[model samples]
Target: ALPDAIEEVSQADQDAFNQDGLGYLADKARTLDALPSDAWEPDLAAFDALIASLAIEGMPETGLMQGSWLWVGQRALGSDAPTPVLDPPAYEIAFGEGDVQVRADCKRADGTYAADGGMTGALSLTLNPTTMQICSEDSQADAFLTALSQVDRFAIAPGAHTMQLFLPDGSVMSFAQAE
Candidate 1:
């Protein structure tokens, strides 16, 4: 009994069992009082091929899990919005064994500063051990700065985390921590 429980079965054996048509084989064996003394190789090979061709699909993740921050924003600036456009918003992530520090800089192709060819105001985040602060250096860029201020603090763990930012006008940005 122990040997039967622990014994291994091979793919070939499995193929042979399936190919033999379990129901039919059982009936024939019962009627004949035993299996045919002749070879049953052809039926076994066909079953092996069928099992070999089968593929299994991957399953998606499921569980109750939460991240530090979650940012959600639109892909386009607005409907029929002109180019040299800026993204809605995006999240930034990093990892450290103890505590991690991360920074993000977001700027549009359009000029927000007086500097030539410089994108509008910069949106940056400085993440310390347990705290993350998002800020904008240029006061003239109130839209981005105000957006940064709305986010409070988040609790980060050793696993994955996310950050989300939203503007007063309802624009949003989000990022996630790496696994």
Candidate 2:
């Protein structure tokens, strides 16, 4: 039997992602409204309440995905923990308009992608079947290809420096923007 399609967030998972990874938010360095004179203070109590209300309403967000990325390794689907790649630079993916270029170990493949995240950031991608050409004995080409095939959705980090392709079974393949 398969596990539940929608797993409720455990307390552990919820706590892990909350208030963490606030690097960008921390750097925001913004105060709602400030008065030039030290003696003057803007009464933002009502404004604070309004801002909290709007946040509860939720805003749709989108991130740019077209670019080159070097495979960084894998992580749990919804987690930010990093797992180092054996030889990070060997694998990479370059996404263009409706198409993707993949470099898996010693093999290369061209394919297509569809991202209709609309407001939710959903994505779909497909790649040509892996080639049969022999790779180095230690190469993980086949495994990488399999992971790519299972990617159903993705998320890009705040700085657009990292991307994670999440598989249905909870394996997330991570990639970093290529220089």
Candidate 3:
């Protein structure tokens, strides 16, 4: 005869199951089953060449940062540099149609901008004055605006997922692209 109740599970066993281990395996099997038999063997060399071209397309272009981005924080050069920390809903900057939309904590602002020379490996950014509203005492509105004002150039990392704004004094403001 079988026991009516099962034994309790341990923490390690639960961890080993992952968040949805069985579900993950099931999905993978389903995907394989959905594939046509002809696709079982692929031209790996052709796929590799196509992927290489896609990488080139991702390289920086003028105003490549045009889109919404989430601020990851700022950092200055050298040994005393402070580590970047993310505060949820920190700040978001949007660039498009020759304009920049800023969300600085509790405050909001908008302005026009020009991006030139990115093709030459040097992207020059110029921003005009923006309309600003005062924010709470604990807000970093002032600092955020100040940093934007000082940005003269910018660079986008590989995969075009991260952008770094550069100031004349060598300060860097990093941001991750928004979905």
Candidate 4:
């Protein structure tokens, strides 16, 4: 039956069917009324090799942190209060070779903040913002600056599109890659 089925299939159709097709056939063979012992033993060496070739050796080290990230929101600080984000005043952070910079646009004015540190390891960040130009209302800009100063570590999501900075005061600032 298998030989007759193979003979009926065209060469192009056979070529189009890859290992996944073989896997499907093998699975179907298991549920059939009768089949040869070798029917379900499709060679999986190619699939294993493909998987092995795509495996990453270790956690991503530096590529994800080298871009501008826009502030989405902050983690809820307490049980009663929810995290609030002021969308009009965009807050952003940019990572350079070994330095970092920050920008926040408050309704009244905008500020530029800079620091002189970067990722110390795969999951660690150390930023000591040396200069801050406080041109906006002190409350929002001051809170954002304080949070930036306290960020000692960071975590990037698997796809590297989203990130979170962990602050010493148990707050997490969430960010997404700037478009």
The whole-model lDDT of each prediction reads 0.33, 0.66, 0.63, 0.55
Models ranked on lDDT: 2, 3, 4, 1
Candidate 1 structure quality by residue, lDDT tens digits, 68-129: 22233322223232222132223322322222222233421121111111111123333323
* Best-to-worst TM-score order: 2, 3, 4, 1
Tens digits of lDDT, candidate 2, 104-150: 88888989888744222446778986566788888877777788887
Residue pairs of candidate 3 with colliding backbone atoms: none
Worst 10 residues of 2 by lDDT: 24-33
Q: Is candidate 3 or candidate 4 better by TM-score?
A: 3
- Which lDDT tens digits does candidate 4 get at residues 1-179? 34576779777656545534533343443355254434444534554355446746653225444578877778743323326657624677776545566666532222333322223212333445434555555335556656766675566776678777766444677788887
**What lDDT does candidate 3 reach at residue 18?**
65
Candidate 4 C-alpha error for residue 59, in Å: 12
- Residue runs of model 3 more than 4 Å from their true location after superposition: 1-66, 79-82, 85-88, 118-133
C-alpha TM-scores of all predictions: 0.21, 0.60, 0.56, 0.48
Instruction: Give candidate 2's error at residue 162 in angstroms.
Output: 0.7
User: Tens digit of lDDT per residue, candidate 3, span 1-179?
Assistant: 22354456556545644654544434454576566655654554565456556645665435455567777878775324544644525688887656678877877777776665342133443545544666667776678778888786667776667887776565677788878
lDDT of 3 at 33: 51
lDDT of 3: 0.63
